[model samples]
Target: MADAAALPSEALTPPGGGPGAGPGPGRAEGAEGLFVVLGAGLAAASHPLLYVKLLVQVGHEPLPPTIGRNVLGKKVLYLPGFFTYARHIVKVDGKRGLFRGLTPRLISSTLSTVTRGNVKKAFPLEDMEHVSNKDDMKTSLRKVVKETSHEMMMQCVSRVVSHPLHAYVSVLLVISMRCMVQFIGREVKYSGVFSAIVRIFKEEGILGFFVGVVPHIVGDVIFLWCCNLLAHFINTYAVDDNFSQASVIRSYTKFVMGIAMSMLTYPFLLVGDLMAVNNCGLRAGLPPYAPVFTSWIHCWRYLSAQGQLFRGSSLVFRRAPMQAACFPID
Candidate 1:
């Protein structure tokens, strides 16, 4: 997912203008609208992978494990990969099933982007051109810290504002009659968004809409800091001075760094999503799949003990534990 909260400072600055020249209201609104559309499109395209991944995360293994050779050439149980899981979903719910829960995901993406843009306008970061221009180590470090801090604050505020929508998406993904229940067995089925919202409010109360928000925010913060700091250091010190002239390469460095940081911080995201649906009445969230957790921390500890903190992270080459061993082949 795009880090809507961490929109580049240059994006907020108007073309042919400096940091002092704020983006024109019309231009800013247009840019945000464009991003909303783009985000929705991206979410739609990626929904299948996310759907299958979420089911995997919740321990809903419909397909039996198959025996495969590990990297070490030992017989090991390999869980269904992304394509296998997706094909199974199609078999059950048809092609349209892959897009289940997309409505709320699009809404969440839009709200997050708009909220971040508005919050950024209200609390614009100070321009660091002077600090950034200086090649001194201390100045570069200071600039990075300032930039990361601004990003962290914006992300946290936006997350808090739009988190209820995220919770809604999680519930929808896990309880929709046409989606989640198709994998984990029919338990509780929500008809539509409004009905689901009312039921969640009644069953889980107001707190239901904010479940697992803390860890999500923390993960974002950590990703921002790590990605920004490392990118800054690499661009400033590690790369050749001439490398800065390659604007295209320089631009991609941050994206690559972000991906790396995301992998490192993915466990937090997994825990956050797990906690959002845990004990929320879906069979996937209840006993036999997962135990009731006292807190997100407890959820984290439980998954850690089971070595499942990274479950569903990989779409392919998923090696299951020996305890789950099945269908061994010579």
Candidate 2:
């Protein structure tokens, strides 16, 4: 029952406290991996729900100032759907229910926005109007392609880097506030914005902030390379009608991109999630409770007949060759 830390390098001592131990490590390390994969599927697959929620919140919810604003100056908002549902549920359950995963979502949202913004600036793939002004179709097209690729890569890396935070936060949103409190006990109350910041700094130190960063960078970078760029590309070439479907097309594009992004970067997200869970998300945070498979099954159950959500995902790549001239969606 010796302390594993004190034990010899090669020895495998008793876990938490056999005779002379403290805490034990079991499947804790592997837990986040499951969340990452599960999280991506949940986000990617149920995108319509997310969009619908956002639409409702922007129309009829009490949230931070960023709802319909093009730029959320200092918003403290949740994802559109989760927040909407949460607000309704909280009306019945109280404040605890409405803001369950506030911390991780805040962190992840900031990171995603920053990542997307920077990548947009760096690549500006969607700004083909400026880049293509030279009137040289061949040159303009090549430039667009390169810029799009670059944007995708940047977005992918950013998403990967931010995956654990996203996954942790999403799980927090899924579980009820009462359940979270039951599981986390005293720590939950102490984990507000100020407390979480100080705790992470003290416990993880500077090195801790970068937890799961590498794997996420890899995963998200690839995610952007595929899906996000597809959005930018769709904007650039395909389905260029100035009508109602334009918005629909964009939404559908984001959905497809979300799936592609999720599929390609899932393993990386899984690795990152595993790291976050092991670091004390279960007791100290909102994730680490839900199993990976269960979440996917949950997503599919609700994803049956959403109409336009999954409409163009399969044809996302196919749009490329035809992109020289867009085909009518109607």
Candidate 3:
């Protein structure tokens, strides 16, 4: 999957690619980036399990009161509850509704991934061969610093470039859903990615496009740093020096690390979604209400007041395994 996403950037890479090349290569690279992005979008949109995962994450489970019962205290007669949420989704919005916001998510994630990949490829790091010496801890520390620097740089570039799409994905996946109306005091009737783009832009302007971006960027850098450092620790102390044994240990560690990282960073993700949802407007002619937060700190205070810093964490736990599975793919 990473290879497919990187194909365009690699194709556009100048012959004998080297660090600090001229900006001319960057233009070709940008255009080529679109192909990989489209491919990523399709892949993300078509994944079967992702559909169910997304629905669950967006508060689609357990049936809302509107669909669960009627005013007379009798079972609300509705479609067969066999595939409860799936049936509800079809009944309410048709089959195509299951794919809501797929385009925005695809664009956001693909751009983020492609941008990071291009940056990493364009500025290849010097091989850390010197870090192999066991006699010096300085070499190990240097290696960690080098890897973290590259990763931080990639993440910063990717997050900035992808902020709009990321915001769109969050809004589409969770914000646009009426489930959040109780918290946000607004009902966003999702009309697909294009409609969302226009509405958010018109209502909230540039700032709306970046709600929760600070936490997202900060959490991303922390997650990457932790993952790299954990891998180094595992490689150094836990795993034996045997090549095959070390390889197996490394693989397992990475999977475990991915889930751990996801769990740790989930609060930031939750906060970001909340901020975005709160900022977006749904009803027309409302003159666009003020956003709930002026900054991530303000958002944190609001969530703290509500005691929902870890709201809907069960979905994140359910989602972690998939995150771990995709670790290598990214």
Steric overlap count per candidate: 0, 18, 0
Give a tens-digit lDDT track for model 2, residues 71-145: 444322222335444555556557554445445554554455455445544554443342222345466557656
Count: clashes, candidate 3: 0
In order, candidate lDDTs are: 0.69, 0.39, 0.52
C-alpha lDDT of candidate 2 relative to the true structure: 0.39
Segments in model 2 whose C-alpha atoms lie over 4 Å from true places? 1-95, 107-115, 118-126, 129-141, 152-186, 228-257, 281-330
Best by lDDT: 1
Which consecutive 10 residues in model 3 have the weakest lDDT in total?
Answer: 1-10
Q: What's the true lDDT of residue 68 in model 1?
A: 77
Model 3 CA lDDT for position 32:
49
Candidates in order, TM-scores: namely: 0.85, 0.40, 0.64
Q: After superposition, how far is residue 170 of candidate 2 from its true place, in Å?
A: 6.9
